[model samples]
Target: MTELLKLSGVHTHIGRYHILQGIDLVVPQGQTTMLLGRNGAGKTTTLRTIMGLWQASKGEISLAGMRIESRATPDIARLGVGYVPESMAVFSDLTVKENLVLAARDGPLDDAQLDWIFGFFPALRRFWLSRAGSLSGGQKQMLSIARAIIEPRKLLLIDEPTKGLAPAIVMALIECLKEIKRKGATILLVEQNFFAARELGDNVLVMDNGTIVHRGEMAALAADVPLQERLLGLSLEAHQ
Candidate 1:
């Protein structure tokens, strides 16, 4: 598979505190890769570093074989990366349609793209007239993802789409993501829900202390109870 992004021995510091410690990973073109680990294990930090939100202190970050470690966030984003943070970054005052319109300003919302998104997230179509703040947690998540689709992106770094959401809503979001994957988007998903990650991911990277400790096919990790307990501090069977 062609490598879309590669991080080699990357390190990041926030003020005096070192966050990413020799992080290394590869995101292959057109695949869904999940980053998994316990809290404070640096999954989010890795994604942020890849997006150039924080400059790496050491090593190289390459996007399609081009060095991007020195680039600014906007410049890096312009290179075809989109980020959907865990906070769901929706404009509270704007209506759902308004938020999507803002995201669609750079280019017209292509009929095919709009049709695809609306099909994946029919709920978004229903709430188009509602203020973003008025939507439920799940509905806001739908809006957040829909906005990302408005921008033409080659790589998407998504953070915890299932966090704090109800089970039914989480399932719906997962199906939407599956549809996104089907449409040829490469996704680096940061998620805490082991079951959901196992279901949606093609590949898995386990991080601890800001570095990748293990990586392999998703089913391999899913079947390893001991590994899950050691890294994630939970039993996979229970999550299932």
Candidate 2:
């Protein structure tokens, strides 16, 4: 598979605390690479580091073979790297339409694009005129993802896209992600939801205590219940 992003010996420091110790990984083009680990294992930090939201204190990060660790956040974004933060990061005061309008960079919102997004997330269309703050958690998550894909993107760094949503919403997200994947978008996802990961990920990278502890095909990890317990202390059956 072709590589879209790579991190070599990447390290990050948050104040006095050392985070993301020596992260080395490759995100393949047109596939989803799931980043999974227990809480506080530096999953979020890794995404932040890749986005240039937090500069790597050491090592190199490249997107499509060009160095980008020192690039500004917006610069990295404009280079086709879209980020859907765990926090969702929607403008609470803005209407759904307004939020999407801001995410489109080149010109007026394309009707076809809006129709495509609405197909993936009909709630976004229903709440088009509503303030984002008034939407439910699931709706807001949908909106966050829709904003990231408002324009064409090459690589997407998504953090916990299924967090705190109902089973129905999770299923919808799963379908939406599958559609995104079918369109050949490269995705680096951080998810605790193993069920979702198993369905969407082609490759998997497992982290522990600020370092990658495992790397393999998602099917290999998902099928090995013993390995899941050892790596994540999680029961694959429970997640199912």
Error of 2 at 154 (Å): 0.4
lDDT of 2 by residue, 1-240 (tens): 889999999999999999889999999999999999888999999999999999999999999999999999999999999999999989999999999999988778999988988887899999999999999998999999999988888999999989899888899888988888788789999988878999999999999999999999999998999999999888655654
Candidate closest to the true structure, highest lDDT: 2
TM-score for each candidate, following the candidate numbering = 0.93, 0.97
Candidate 1 stretches with Cα past 4 Å from truth are 237-240
| Candidate 1: residue 215 Cα off by (Å) | 1.2
lDDT of 1 at 182: 79
Please provide, for model 1 over 61-105, each residue's C-alpha lDDT reduced to its tens digit, 9 standing for 90 to 100: 999999999999889878888889898989989998888888775
RMSD to the native, candidate 1?
A: 1.6
Window of ten residues with lowest summed lDDT in model 2: 231-240
